[model samples]
Target: MKKIKITILFLALLQTFSAVAQSSKIKNLENQREQIKKEIIEINNLLSSNKKEKNLTFRDLEILAAKINIKERLIKINNDQINLLNADIKSNEIKSEELKLENENVRKDYASMIFNSYKSRLKESRIMFLLSSSTFLEAFKRSQYFSQFSDDRKKYSNKILKNLTSLDSINKILKDKIVNKEDLIKSNNAEKRDLSNERNNKNNALSSLKRKENAYKRQINQKQRQADLLDKEIDKLIKEAIRLSNENKKSSTFSLTPEAKALAESFTKNKGNLPWPVERGAIIQKFGLQPHPVVRTTKIKSNGIVIATTKDANVRSVFEGVVLSILKFKGSNLTVLIKHGNYISAYKNLSKVFVEKGDNIDALQIIGEAYTNINDNKTTLQFSIFNNTTPLDPYLWIAK
Candidate 1:
């Protein structure tokens, strides 16, 4: 009985841990799904609305591809949840069988105990047995035995009832798990269908893009030139900034004053604590080299990340800085360069500017609103961070 109870307790604990683990994983996957969903929603709400907003550009195709990929991943997670449920149900079924068998054995043992006790009492009544004692000491011993026998019978009956109760509880839990498992399967199938539909949508978008291959290539070239021009201008401005910083000190490096050094150190320490340039947007184009979304063989180099945001959305500084320059080039939106000690953060593609050169700005201060390209039907901000003229990956510096 002790071993059987220990086994049941161990199984119960194991089941609890297994269930908790599966629940945690499922919860984590659900959270990831929600985040992706939010990103999709933001993209759709902020972009892809105008008549020119068909799936004709890389950004549009990228969004569709991302949506399909996320849905597929969501389906995979649902399947994983269903698999875990199936596994748990099967394991519990085995445990339930073992418990039922043990309960039956306990019932039999309890009946045998009762029968033996009855037989002993019938053969020699308790009073008669006490009276049959040869002496006082013998009577005393027989009386103690009678009491112990009664207590043992009560204990045996209680143990049998407890085992039966446990068995019933296990059976109920198993039934519940089975029902839950069925529900998970249904949800899994639904997600799979959703995934299939997403894939179909992706195919349709890709087909639309494929139809305009030549025109799309020319558009890509034009956009690439624009990006290259932006990069060059930003680079030139940063070099000029570095030169200016070093001019007074007659050195190639920035001469940090006491306050400047402290601020620089603080900014360095908060590498992953900086806020985003826009409050709500998705990083459509990440920093560094990326393959074209439709033309896989074509490569594009980016000095910064492009955030697609709502039209006229305010662009804010990620950190405290002094405005160094506001660059305006033909065929490009306004760009603001702000310096924080030896570091510089650049906000580009603005329809309006609120800050001027030499303005001291606080963290998350709105410098300008993002530019909305009327012809392209796009609204986005290009953000860059530099450590003294050296480009740093913006993602490493921004909060997730």
Candidate 2:
């Protein structure tokens, strides 16, 4: 019986810890859902206010598609949360039932012990028991037996009280978990409804944009050329940096400066913990091949990374490095490339520049302010990282 009570107590504590962990995960999911909702609202406002033939460029369509995708992801997360909460609630209910049964057994044992002890302690019973002894030795043995019986009774009573306290605590914890589950269910339902509305809005916006293909194609071509030119300039700078790095080698082995080496080490150490370059943003284009959202038959490839953010957000350095080049595009924006040991990080589409060629930059240092499209009020930064011209997926490096 003692072993059984101890086992029950241990299981109860474990269940309490599991509940806490689940609650934390639910809170994090809720926060992310809220952010997605805000982005959807921003997109809706942009779609409704503009009446100038809808420009309806490829970039505009891409932004709307990304918003819709985020909304869908949010809905899935909500459903998952609901399912998990329901499971937890059921588990807690089962645990509560077990606790109740254990408590009842403890109470019954305690009551039985109390009744037996009372019967043994009666005045008539005690006198009869003493007189029944045949000799002095027998009487002495009888006294010892009474003493042992009294001690056993007291111990049993104490054990029952302790079990009762534990049962009370477990019951309270289970009750709280039940309430939490109900709250989570309500929240999930609300988020699901909001996501459905956003999806509908996105469908409407996509339909309107699909009607203006000629103007959209022109815009896409111009943007593609701009992107290509930026890519070439970045490649040239990377080759130059690599050559300089090689020339400065000692004895046939390449060596980076102490500062550059330290930056590289720090950046590597924060592989999965580095923050995004933009302060407030979402990833519009992922790192690999994806079907074009608007052109169902077409596929789009992203070499580096594309982050969509609020207007005028400053692009910051991910780690300490030296500025390699600041290339001016044909339009109004500039692109800054920084070199950290053999690694390269590029920040493009900046209307204003704070860092220049040959300037030393520290981690999280501001390189430039990102440009916002006046027509759509959309701000984005094209960020990329390379290892001697070999592009790496920035998504894998940034913190989730």
How high is each candidate's TM-score? 0.66, 0.76
- TM-score, cand. 2: 0.76
Checking candidate 2 for backbone clashes, the offending pairs are: none
- C-alpha lDDT of all candidate models, in order: 0.78, 0.74
Per-residue error for 288 in candidate 1, Å, reads 6.6
Provide the clashing-pair count of each candidate structure: 0, 0
Model 1 error, position 97 (Å): 2.9
What's model 2's lDDT at 349? 84
Q: Tell me how far the alpha carbon of residue 57 in candidate 1 is from the true structure, in angstroms, after superposition.
A: 4.7
TM-score of 1: 0.66
Per-residue lDDT tens digits for candidate 2, residues 341-380, read: 7678888888888988899988889889999887666677
Q: How far is candidate 2 from the true structure (C-alpha RMSD, Å)?
A: 4.8
Maximum-TM-score candidate: 2
What is the model-wide C-alpha lDDT for candidate 2? 0.74
